[model samples]
Target chain A: MIEDRPLIYKYLRHDKKFPHVWCGGCGIGILLGSLIRAIDHLGYTKDEVVLVSGIGCSGRLPVYVDFNTLHTTHGRALTFATGVKLAKPELKVIIIMGDGDATAIGGNHFIHAARRNLDLTAIIVNNNIYGMTGGQYSPTTPYGQRATTAVYGSVEHSFNIAQLAVCAGAVFAARGTVYHVRQLDGLIEKALLKNGFSVVEVISQCHTHYGRLNKLGNQIDMMKQQRDSAVPVEKARKMSPEEMEGKFEIGILVDREAPNYLEQYNKVRQKAKNALSLQLTKEEKEESERREALDKQ
Target chain B: MHRRKKPEPKAQLMQGNEACAEGALIAGCRFFAGYPITPASEIAEHLSYRLPQVDGTFIQMEDEIASMGAVIGGSLAGVKSMTATSGPGFSLMQENLGFACMAEVPCVVVNVMRGGPSTGLPTNPSQGDVMQARWGTHGDHPIIVLSPSSVMECFTLTVKAFNYSEKYRTPVIFLMDEVVAHMREKVVLPEPNEVTVIDRVKPSVPPEWYLPYEDTSFGVPPMGIFGEGYRYHVTGLVHDIRGFPTLRQDEIEPFLLRLFRKISIHFADIQLVESFHTEDADLVIVAYGCTFRSAHRAMVEARARGLKVGLLKLITIWPFPRRVVEPLTRAKKTLLVPEMNMGQISREVKRVNQGMTTVLTVNKIDGTMITPQEILEKIEEEKK
Candidate 1:
């Protein structure tokens, strides 16, 4: 409630629970600022927006926002968002989840939601490790990276979330890192405005767990790595595959137009209604003809 | 193509699952999310075609968990929502069921009872889920579970299920077995105005003053719809009156107590039992779901042979209807409990009876329903 604060503060909960639960210098906090700024820039009423999140450091984001918020179970934010969007299609719903939440326990819902192409925005924070429950490896953890469960380094490869969404039929898919705040805001704003399933994979830092275990220094060092190794999609396409082996692509990877669930269902409703009316008219005509025949008799 | 709404035919031969879908429509439920499962799939199938005609939305989700999740989401967005599944799918829905309980989301989950430890009998009937329906979720949360024995009760009780769910702001379980779910019978569909439908109370206060979980004299607070300017936070975690997650013991204790107390205080309204010929009978048969039909038939056969027998059919399964059952134990000398499961509800009867009367049970667990002959034999054995 302090005056002279940033306009983004208008979207934050001013009553209580001031300091957030995310670790100091956590990339999740940075992403929160970007999300607020993006929503503010879009000029949507707080009442017309719903922020849903799943269990993780990111799940706590909704409680701090002034908009209608729901903190759902682990990995199930998108499913809930689907219901909300279908029921109240006018509302803009943005879902937030960690790497494990979106691709691990909730992986089935994620891919299916994209395939269904519901108009929802999914913001996934890929911290490479489970930060809330300590230093456990996540589905987006780098191959051969150290975690609490991976004392000898991980053997499984990581999921490129943006590419997964694109393959799963999302109309809009983009990747950004916390180091590129301006670009992250733009990606989020675009995803929010997309008319079909949209996704923004945020490569973030978890210095307390993933970074500490993997010897990635502090939050600044991890952010510096994101800036150095990340390549724009256009630039990466021109470079040789061997030259960009360890680097990741950033920027809009896919943008296309398709009918969202609500738009398709509206047509389904109209068709079903037309069929019913036709059936009713046929029945009514048969009844009238039978009555006239009876009168002639 | 706008046209006048027409009332359905007064009398028709309908399957139990078909009746449930009709009941949901008449009861003001506009959102349905479910997966295809045996015995229960017909409910979803019927709704998928019926909902769009009424401008309602029906979604076939990837699994039961997401179906339950979506139903909750729809309910939170100010729509009446529901899902239907059988045992295996119901097992997958337990966690989300608990979430609905904690979040106080009003939705109906129809679990068509099939034999199961793990996909035991998909096409057959069993009352084994009686206990699971009561305590399937992993918490001490309160729930309202209703069962239907015939096609007519399938329609009427489903309407009642939605009423209680909306009034209590809690999930209600419509427990229908395969026998009753598939059985076809003549039911008189009520006119639009005949059946009473209850909607959740909307917040009367302004948006700024709305507290989602504020404790009131009745322990049930008003609900505000999402995206309607009443911005609030909802979570599965234990939350305070403001609906924000709380770790303080003071807020947690009050929140849990109010949830339980809201249902407990309204036990008389929540409990529904059908009594037949119990006034002058010395022995009574307690049954539910499809098994109630056998118990009723057995009672008539026993009465023809000059044995005084009565039937007490439980329409509301959870909260146990202890008041109704306890009084019968005091008056009746012998109580015969016959069900498809070993002894799920009989144990509840014994706990309430407290050895006041002999509680004899006829258990059957081979994926077939208990027969009237078996129940009559148990009654005859008690006489001998």
Candidate 2:
């Protein structure tokens, strides 16, 4: 049981807004709890943080938190969070998005934000289907999985979000599952502390939609499946791609130190200031000499 | 208390787009997000260099949609933010533009008008987006759009756009055509003391009691920026004064009505139109943006030939300036509207005229400016 429940309660808006819209046996509540614990462990106050979310079931997470939150249009959380981070570089900006919200309509912004290496953390909750819209297939829905839109089973391939983030130039990329709360909390904290674009994709269970459609059993069975299917990166490195077909590799995929966009932007500002100051000093010297000459006359 | 003396106004020969960028800087705009588009690209280019000089942030977004979203985010974070785009890019910005209206986020969007339904002409002048700027975004929402006629006006109007956006808590569109955007003219920018800058009203109440969308008598609630200690929610949904999503009719109706009433109630302050030689003229030419330049010339030429003609140049196109247009139509004379598009704004002229006067349209849509000669010929033909 959480002995520091008071500390966690300080970070939540549990007034009449209690009992959030997340379904019973939903993994989103667990993920949100882990995020709160991570931020609490990092010692970041509510005033120093901002939570931005796009439109989806997971996107509703920000409205329940006690931070400066923005619930924006679907798939645009990263874009809006980028602006918030750039505008106030001192604040810790975090984005919560669903699988469809991140990789489908918002895919362009995802790649570009990663490529720019802006200082922001994106936490993608991947339930493999559009949970808010009733069991529709999403970009992350595994091929051959049954969704409402894929009644005959999905013909399209799924995206490996952690791998996609790594290839897209994200400075920090990792995978975590809701079943492993402690590890997921650590991954989220590490991603938030990274100086550049970071993504922690948590494979959540949508027992209401994705699980029911795919006949993946109840919430407890789904949690057990996730725990069994997730292979840590160190262990997975010993196996071949063929051996890791149905299992997802957990742990950090990419963690590298690179100059973030804000650092480079600061250099640009310094250069412009130096150039402007040089021009101003030259003008000032000329004006002083002219004034001295006028006095001599 | 010692006050720093204001710097004197400096005369500079600058392009309209550059002037618009400079005006944004003067208006306390510290953040800019935009994609490169022809005619309007200079605004982004200029700001990319100028913003950093002022310790402001400038980002070249991936597309116009993200640019608009970033601008909204920046505004929510307590910085005056802006984005510039041409017609095609402006079309891409409509969805978020509506979000800004519905959420009551204050920001400026500069649409340097180019010929387009879709990339019709990138580098050509067109008033084609006048109607798009008004009604392009889905649903009925209040919007303020100010079109600049000259390079000097581009500078002044851009500042006005930011002021109006902050004052009204809504997005203000700076609609410029390619003619004014690219044209170079000697502009005497106002001294710092001469200019009146408006900042968004912030909440005077304590942080715990703050409501982001609190319904006030003036229809505009004080906006609190992120990290300012007022942690309030903001959503695109139809929300109550607390900024939370609600479907209750009473809460939703008041919220929606206030969005419209804030602009409509202040029509006197928001509506701006410049009338030239329409005092005793039987022929009144209605035009805006670059076409107004040609209309002014044609009005003078027609008057010289013993024709009673005048020009009604629209500076504030949205909210339509019906008070100014209604009286002119009551005279029962011919009203000619010429534009670079095939009768977009002319339809508005006709609609406002309500058959009180003969509304004739002289349209040119082949990526060319409507020439003074063409408008003058139309005036002569209408007289016959």
Give the number of the best model, judged by DockQ: 1
- TM-score (C-alpha, index-matched) for candidate 1: 0.97
B1-384 per-residue lDDT for model 2 (tens digits): 434444445688999999999999999999999999898999999999889988999999999999999999999999999999998899999988988999899999999988777888899888888788889999988899999999989988888999999999999999999999999999898877778899999998999888889878887999998998999888998887888888789898888989999999899999999989888998899998888898999988998999999889999999789898888999776899998888887888888888788999998888888899999999899889
Task: State how far residue A154 of model 1 sits from its true place (Å).
Answer: 1.0
lDDT of 1 by residue, A1-297 (tens): 133147657878887466778889899988988898888889999999999999999999999989999999998898889889888888999999999999999999999999999999999999999999998999988899999999999999999899999999999999999999999999999999889999999999999999899999999999999999999999999999899988999999999999888889999999989988999999989877866666666
Name model 1 segments beyond 4 Å from true: A1-5, A286-297, B1-9
Task: Report the lDDT tens digits of candidate 2 across residue range A1-297.
Answer: 377578667777864246789899999989888899899889988987999999999988988889999999988888888888889989999999999999998999999999999999999999999999999999999999999999999999999988999999999999999999899989999998899999999999999988899899988899999999999999999999999989998999989988999999999999988888888999889877866666666
Position A208, candidate 1: lDDT? 97
DockQ for every prediction shown: 0.56, 0.55
Give candidate 1's error at residue A43 in angstroms. Answer: 0.5
Candidate 1 lDDT score at position B290: 95
Question: How accurate locally is residue B103 in candidate 1, as Cα lDDT from 0 to 100?
Answer: 89
Candidate 1 residue-wise lDDT, B217-252, digit = tens: 887889899988789999999998888888999999
Best by lDDT: 1
